[model samples]
Target: MNDMDKTRLRINRSLILQEVRIEHVRDFLYQEGIISEEDMDRCGNVTKTPRERIACLLDLLPRRGPEAYKAFCSGLQETYPWVVEKLNSTPIPETQTKTLSSTVLPNKEMNTGETSERQRIREPYTELNHTVIKIVTRSEALNKYKDVVRALGVPQPDIDQIEYANFRDLQEQFYQCLLKWQSREGRNATVVRLIEVLREEDYNSVADKLDGYID
Candidate 1:
């Protein structure tokens, strides 16, 4: 199959997964009597709706499914307005941290009215250093990396087709794209611009490269 076909198939698979998730939620809500059978059917068929029309609606209404669901639960809010408000108000929780402590004993006591030697020596700032170095984890980094990869139309191989060298090369190219994106201020550029860069970098040939890497 051609690259575009392969890409579309991957996308369709992802969409199917999303649809199944949505359907599960829909069925649960319906069974609970939160949504009528009619509404459930309408929401379930969302994938059949034209994406272009949905995109236009998103431009005008500015909402997502979860946001809409939350707004529906809010009772006081109008559907579209609540959806927009909830979407805008969605919160990303801060990362969690762990603290460690070490204790040191004094070798000698200080002179009169002075502190002990151990008291004089400041404790190493483990918490402070942890705070300073605190950043997104590898999994979070990879998640964000994959988002840009998908947006750029970079090819993704099935698990069985992935190989070490090809994965490394793809990662290197992704980092390069990230750096370029950062340097460009990552603003005002269209999705098409990012896709163009990926194409130029031959990231579109990822499947073939994976085969070569395995060989």
Candidate 2:
């Protein structure tokens, strides 16, 4: 396929993936009465009963062709068995950080002369507990992002490297960094920095194209 055709297919795949994730959330919400039976019914056939429809939607079968959806769901189940479990289970309590203080003396030999030793703040967890929550909460959006990534069929080590909780944070940081980098040094610097931060070839490619017009 031509480049434009390929781009469109990637976009479509992303949209499909996002829809599937949103459907899963919708199913969970419906089960909890967060959404009404009427809204649930509006989602339409993927199953014989309303309850079954929840499963069908989460499985992404109603929209995808049966065979493909089945295979995809199976593969996803294998890859992320905990996804449903986590979604269904109660969310964990948010962790809190504790600040500890240490005695410090100012001396040329003891404290490097002037600056006081900073107290180390211990994190409650090795990583943020909310990372998974954010991932689950934003699954629909991330799934859309994943679709584009999947279409490229190229490894996205950087995207994989980010902690799930940090996805939104990282994106925000990158945007701010891009604005600063672009303003100071122009398009080339901004594109390079964006690629470094995003670590996705597709995003880098797009950033390169948009570089000139960025302020």
Best by TM-score: 1
lDDT of 1 by residue, 13-95 (tens): 33333322343244444443234344445555655554432332222111121122332234323323433354335443232
lDDT (Cα, tens digit) per residue for candidate 2, span 1-215: 12222232333443334334434455444333233344456555554554554444443322221122223334445444554233324232233111111222322334344433331111112121233223322333232343222222212233343324356674433333223333444423322233232333234444443332231
* Candidate 2 to truth, TM: 0.18
Candidate 1: C-alpha RMSD to true structure equals: 19.5
Clashes of 2: 0
TM-score of each: 0.20, 0.18
lDDT of 1 at 89: 53
lDDT of each: 0.33, 0.34
lDDT of 2: 0.34
